[model samples]
Target: MIRTLLALNGALIRGALAFVLTTQEDIEVVAEVERAEDIGTALRTQRPDVAVADVNLFGAGVLSAGGASSGPPPVLVLVDPRRPKVLGDALRARCQRLGFLGSDVAPERVVEAVRRLAHGGSVVDADLVVAALNRDNPLTAREVEVLEIAAEGWPVVEIASKLSLSSGTVRNHLCRIAGKTGARTRIEAVRIARERGWI
Candidate 1:
C-alpha cells in the first residue's frame, strides 16, 4: 500500500480525503494533521510515503526544497487555482518531485496523483501547468519588493522610510502597482499581489 499522511488545513477536506483514500486498495491514509506546526512532528514520526497538503502547509522558511531530512516526504500539495497561480513551481523549486493538483480536482485524479507520487513520479494539473507556463509576474523586482512590504498594511511614508526612499517615490510605486494590477487602490493591489502569490 502507498502510505500517505495528510497535512491539510481544512477539517472537512481532511475527513473526506481520508474516506476516499481509505477505500482504495493500494493507498493508506497513515496520519492526518490539522495544524501547520504539527506537520514536522507528524512527518518525522509517521514517515509516510507521501504527504498530501495545501500550499500554506509548505510555508516559507518552514520547508526546504531539497531532499533533506528537514524536508517533507514527497508531497502532493493541493493548490487553489483561483489564487497564486504558480504555487506548483514555487514548491517544486524548493523540493524535487513535488506533486500538484487543483484544490477542486476530482477524487479519482487525487488518487491517481498519489499513486503516481508514491512510485517516484510527479503530477501537476494540466490547467495549472499551462497557467504556470503562461503566467509571468509583471512587476519588476523593486516593484514586487515594494508591494510585498505594502502587504503588511504599511503607510506610504513608513514604507518609503523602510525601503530608504522618498514618500513621493513610494506613492509612485503604489500607483504603478495599482495600475499594473488593475487595482483602484493600494489595498486592492496588495490583495491582488497576495492572491497571485507575487507577495
Candidate 2:
C-alpha cells in the first residue's frame, strides 16, 4: 500500500479527498496536518510513501530550496487554477519528487499522481508548467524584496532601514515596480506581483 499524508487547510476538501483516497485499494493515509511548517516533521515521523498537500495559500512554505538536510521526501501539492501563485511556494519547496495537481483534479488523476510519485515519478500540472516556462520576473531581485516587505505593510522609512537604502530609493523602487506592473498604486502593484507569483 502507498502510505499517504495530507497537509491541506480546507476541512471539507481534505475530508472529501481523504474519502476518495481511502477507497483506493493501494493507498492509505498515514496522517493529516494543517500547517505547511509541520510537513517536514510529519514526514520524518510517519515516513509515508507519498505526501499529498494543498498549498493554495502560498505561505512561507514547507521546504527551503536545498538547505541543510539530505533532502525532503516526495511531495505532491494540490493547487487552485484561480490562485496559481501557490505554485511559487511549491517551487520554493525544493523537494526531490514534487508534483502538482489541479484542485479540481479527478479522483482517478489524484490516484494516478500519487501512485506515480510513490513509484519515483514526477508529475506537473499543465498550468504550473506554463507558469514555470513563461516567467519573466519584471522586477529586479531587490525590487522583489522591497515589494514583499511592502506587501506586509512596512512603511517607506522602515523598508529603507531594513534594506540599508535611503527612503527616496525605496520610493523609487516602488514607483518602478508600479510602472512595470502597470499598477496605479503600491497596493495594486503588490497584488499584481502576487498574482504573477513574483513575490
Candidate 3:
C-alpha cells in the first residue's frame, strides 16, 4: 500500500480527496494538514511514502531549493495554472522526488501521480514544463533584492539605505531591472517580475 499524506487547505476538499483515496485498495491517507508549517512534523511522525500538497504552500522561505535532501518523502504538488507564480514556487523548492499536476485534474489522475511517485517516477504537466524551460528569469540576485524592496513601496533612497548602497547605485539597479523586465517604469517592472515570480 502507498501511504500518502494530504496537505491541502480546505476541509471539504481534503475530506473529499481522502474519501476518494480510501476507495483505492492500494493507497491509504496517513495524515492530513491544512498549513505548510505542519508538513514537516507530519512527515516526521507519519513517515508517509508520498505527500500531496498545494503549490502555494511552497512559497519563499517555506521550502528552500535543497530542503528535502533525504528527510522528507516524495511530494506531488497540485498547481493552479491561473496562479503561475505558485508554479515558480514549486520549481524553486527543487525537491528531488517532486511531481506536478494541474490542480483541476480529476482525482484519479492524482491517484496515478501518487502511484508513479511512489515507484520512483515523476509526474509533471508537459505544457507547464515547456513554458518554465523557455521563459527563465533574467535578473541577477542583487537586482532581485532591490526589486523586492521596491515592491514594498520603498523609495530609492530608503532602498539604498536598507541595502547599504548609494542612491545612484540603487537607481542604476532599478533602471537595469526595468530594462531586463521590458517595462517602461519601475512599478511595471516590479509587476512583471512579480507576475512571472522572478522576485
Candidate 4:
C-alpha cells in the first residue's frame, strides 16, 4: 500500500483528495494538514511514503539537500499553470523524487502522479514542462528589484528612498522596465513579470 500525506490548503480540496485517494485500494490518506506550518510535523510523525502538497505550501525549500532518510518524503506538488513562478521555484529545487501536476488536472491524473512519486519516479505535466523551458525572465537584476518593490504597491518616491536612488533615477528605471516588458503601466509590468516568472 502507498501511504500518502496531504498538505493542501482548502478544506474542500483536502476532503475531496482524501476521499478520492482513499478509494484506491493501494493508497491510504494517512494525514491531512491545512496549514503550511503543519507539513514538517506531519512528515516526521507519519513517515508517509509520499506527500501531496500545494506548491504555495511546500515551496522549493521542501526539496532541501537531504534524502528521504534525512528529509521529507518524496512530494508531488500541485501547481497552478497560471503561476509560472511557482513552477519555476519547483524546477529550481532540482529534487529527483519531486513530481509536478497542474492543479486543475483530473483526479485520475493526481492518482497517477502520486503513484509515480511513490515509486521514486519523476512526473511533470507536458504543458508545465514547456512553460519551464520558455520561461525566460527578461528583466535584469536591478530592474527585477525595482519591479518587486513596485509590485508591493510602493510609490516611486518611497521606492527611491528605500533603494537609495534619486526619484528621477527610480522613474527612469520604471520607464525602462515598462519598455523592456512592453507593459503600459507599473502594475501591468509586475503582473507580466510574475506570470513569466521573471520577478
**What are the C-alpha RMSDs, in order, of all predicted structures?**
3.4, 4.7, 5.0, 2.9
| Best candidate, lDDT | 4
* Per-residue lDDT of 3 in model 3: 89
Superposition TM-score, candidate 3 onto the true structure: 0.67
Model 1: pairs clashing at backbone N, Cα or C within 3 Å? 65-94, 65-95
Q: Give the per-residue lDDT digits (tens) of candidate 3, residues 8-86.
A: 9799998999999989999999998888778777776777888888876643222332224465677888886544666
Q: Write the per-residue lDDT of candidate 2 for residues 1-199, one digit (tens) a residue.
A: 9988888887887888889999999999887778777776676777777777777432333453221144555678887655555676567754557889877778789889999988889899886668666766899999999999999999999999999999999999999999999999889999888777677
Report how far residue 91 has shifted in candidate 4, in Å: 3.1
Of candidates 4 and 1, the better by TM-score: 4
Cα lDDT listed for each candidate: 0.78, 0.78, 0.81, 0.83
RMSD of 2: 4.7
Q: Which ten residues in a row have the lowest lDDT in candidate 1?
A: 59-68
After superposition, the stretches of candidate 1 with alpha carbons farther than 4 Å from their true spots are 59-72, 83-94
Give the distance in Å from residue 4's predicted Cα in candidate 1 to where it truly belongs: 1.2
TM-score of each: 0.83, 0.73, 0.67, 0.83
lDDT of 2: 0.78
Model 1 vs. true fold: TM: 0.83
Candidate 4 Cα misplacement greater than 4 A, ranges: 59-71, 176-185
| Quality of model 1 by C-alpha lDDT | 0.78
Query: Candidate 2: where are CA atoms >4 Å away?
Result: 37-47, 55-73, 79-95, 164-166
The Cα RMSD of model 1 versus the native structure comes to: 3.4
Worst 10-residue lDDT window for candidate 4 reads 59-68
Note the residue pairs that clash in candidate 3: none
lDDT: the better of candidates 2 and 3? 3
